[model samples]
Target chain A: DMKVTQMPRYLIKRMGENVLLECGQDMSHETMYWYRQDPGLGLQLIYISYDVDSNSEGDIPKGYRVSRKKREHFSLILDSAKTNQTSVYFCASSSHGESSYEQYFGPGTRLTVL
Target chain B: QQQVRQSPQSLTVWEGETAILNCSYENSAFDYFPWYQQFPGEGPALLISILSVSDKKEDGRFTIFFNKREKKLSLHIADSQPGDSATYFCAASEGMGYKLTFGTGTSLLVDP
Candidate 1:
């Protein structure tokens, strides 16, 4: 089955601590994205990776970093966790081309920083 | 600046009523528009989408109306049900790639 999986559905971390959110997809899609969703504010794009080493910053790339070392894996790392970074993080992937606009999202990871 | 804007922050409608969520974009390069539905504590899912070439697209009770000149589009959900209550987001893509600009989102509540 085609699915996107996110490890640690929920996480709690202390300020200044480093955190990692892992995402994997079984579809072998060419494009992967990370977005953070908050109340009132919609999902904000953080980063998008087209290939193993190609990565681009989206609108809200600050305070967050991503790595796509493999075709089916994309990871988001928080260099220093902060209270303001607490939000629901979503991982998605899509194929290459115009018709692949739709993104298949994972269950999501809710991170809390104290 | 926010590339896309959504209005009515939220809407409450009775069952069987039609719920209309509006979205507008500022980028003229946007050629594709898609609506995503997100449930509480869950990831958003693709609901429906429309292309610049077509003025309208429909799927079951969900329909998307696009206006290329206005750079605006709307999602109409007919016969709103309690299960349909969720957050709706409108997204636009300029050229290609998986990069998309999303709206602030409009939460819909359907009371039965």
Candidate 2:
């Protein structure tokens, strides 16, 4: 089955600490994305990776960065976690050519910064 | 500014009734629209979608009514069930683009 997987479904970190969220997709999609969901704010895009080493910032990319070293894996890193950064993070992947609009999302990671 | 907007932040409907979710966008360049369903504690999943070229698109019991002139669209869920109790998001993307701008969402509750 085609699936997207994320590690550490739940995480807690002290303010100013570092964080790493990993995502993997078995579909070998060329486009991968990172999004954060906050109450009443909907899903805000953080970054979009078109392919290996080709990444673009989304609407909200501050305090966060992404890495795509392979076709099936993407990573989101928080250099200095802040309390306001606490939210559910989602990782999604989509095909390159036809219907790239349909993004298959993973289970998501609930991160809390204290 | 919020490019996409959804109404009825919350909605309630009987199991056999139809639920209507409204959405609007400010970007005229957005030609593709998709609705996503999210269960509690899970990421959102694609439920249905419509292109600006079409006025209506249907799949199963879900239908999307689009009006390119008005820059508005809506999702009608026929025979809503308790299983349909979840959050629905309206998202839009520019011409054949990958970045999607999403609305806040509507929390739907289907009572049985």
Candidate 3:
């Protein structure tokens, strides 16, 4: 089955702590994205990864970083967790070229920074 | 600045009724528009999409009506059912594989 998986569906961290959210896909898609969704603000893009080791910052990348060491895996890291960072995180993957416009999303990770 | 915007933060409709969700964008460069449906505790999923070249696209009971000149679009759900109740978001992107700018979603309730 084609699917995107996110680990630690829920996480709670203290302020200033380092946090890691992992995502994996089985479709071998070349493009992956990380987004944070909050009430009223909707889904805000955090990062976009085009294949292994090629990542670009999205509009809301200030407090987040991403790693894509493999085509099927993408990780979102928060260097120093902040209370403002508490939100639901989503990971998505898509193929290259024409089909890149369609993204398949994972279940999502709900993170709480206290 | 919000590039994409949605109207009627929330809407309630009876089952089998037609529900309309409105969306508008500010950037002229945006060429691809897509609507997503998200249920509570789940990530958003693509519902329907329309390109600037096409004025309308239909799939089953969902249709997207686009007006490129006005930089606006709307999603019409025909015969809406309780199962279709979810938050709907409007999003736009300028180029292929580019990050999408999303609008604050419209919470839809289809009461049976």
Candidate 4:
């Protein structure tokens, strides 16, 4: 079955600490995305990776960064965790061609910054 | 500013009743609309989608009604069941655009 997996399903970090959330997909999809879902904000995009080493910032990219060193892996990095950064993060993947815009999401990572 | 918006922050319906969730977008460039269903502590899953070219699309008991002129769309759930009681989100994107703009979800509750 096609699937996307995220590591560290739940995380807690102190303010100003560095954080990393990992994601992997088996479908070899070319496009990967990172998003943070808040209470009334729905899913706010953080970053979009087209392929290995090709990443673009999304609407809410101010406090986050992403790395896509391989086709099957994508990582979201928080240089300095802040209390306001606490939210559920989701990783999604999709092909560039046939499944142009349909994204398959991972279980999600709930991060709490104290 | 939120490009996509959903109405009726929360809705309660009885089983076997039809539940209507409304959505509207501000960007005219958005042509593809999709609805996602999310349960607590889980990721959202794709439920149904519609393109600007088509006015209606149906799958199983879920239907999407689109209005290109009004930049609005809605998801109609026929015979809503307790299993279908979950948060529903409306999302939109431009043609071939990899990014999607999502709206604040509409929470649904189906009483048995």
Best by DockQ: 2
Query: DockQ of every model listed?
Result: 0.80, 0.87, 0.79, 0.82
- Local distance difference test, each candidate: 0.91, 0.95, 0.92, 0.94
Sorted by lDDT (best first), the order is 2, 4, 3, 1
Q: For residue A9, what is the lDDT in candidate 1?
A: 99
lDDT of 1 by residue, B1-112 (tens): 8889998899999999999999999999988888999998788899998889899999999999898888889999999999999999999887654678889999999999
- Predicted structure 4: clash tally: 0
Residue-wise C-alpha lDDT for candidate 1, range A2-114, written one tens digit per residue: 99999989999999999999999999898999999887778898999987989999888999999999999999999999999999999999986645667999999999999
**Candidate 4 residue pairs in clash (backbone atoms < 3 Å):** none
Backbone Cα, N, C clashes tallied per candidate: 0, 0, 0, 0
* lDDT, model 4, position B81: 98
Candidate 1: what lDDT?
A: 0.91
Query: What tens digits encode model 3's per-residue C-alpha lDDT throughout A1-114?
Result: 989999989999999999999999999889999999998999999999988999998998998899889899999999999999999999999885655477889999999999
For model 3 chain A, the run of ten residues with the poorest summed lDDT: A94-103
True contacts kept of each: 0.89, 0.83, 0.78, 0.75
TM for every model, in the order presented, reads 0.96, 0.98, 0.97, 0.98
Off by over 4 Å in 2: none
Q: What is residue A83's positional error in candidate 4, in angstroms?
A: 0.6
- Ten consecutive residues with minimal summed lDDT in candidate 4 chain A? A94-103
Candidate 4 CAPRI level: high
Q: Write one digit per residue (lDDT tens) for candidate 2, span B1-112.
A: 9999999899999999999999999999999899999999898999999999999999999999999999999999999999999999999998858999999999999999
Docking class of 3: medium
Local accuracy of candidate 2 as per-residue lDDT tens digits, A16-93: 999999999999889999999999989999999999999999999999999999999999999999999999999999
Q: What is the DockQ score of candidate 3, to 2 decimals?
A: 0.79
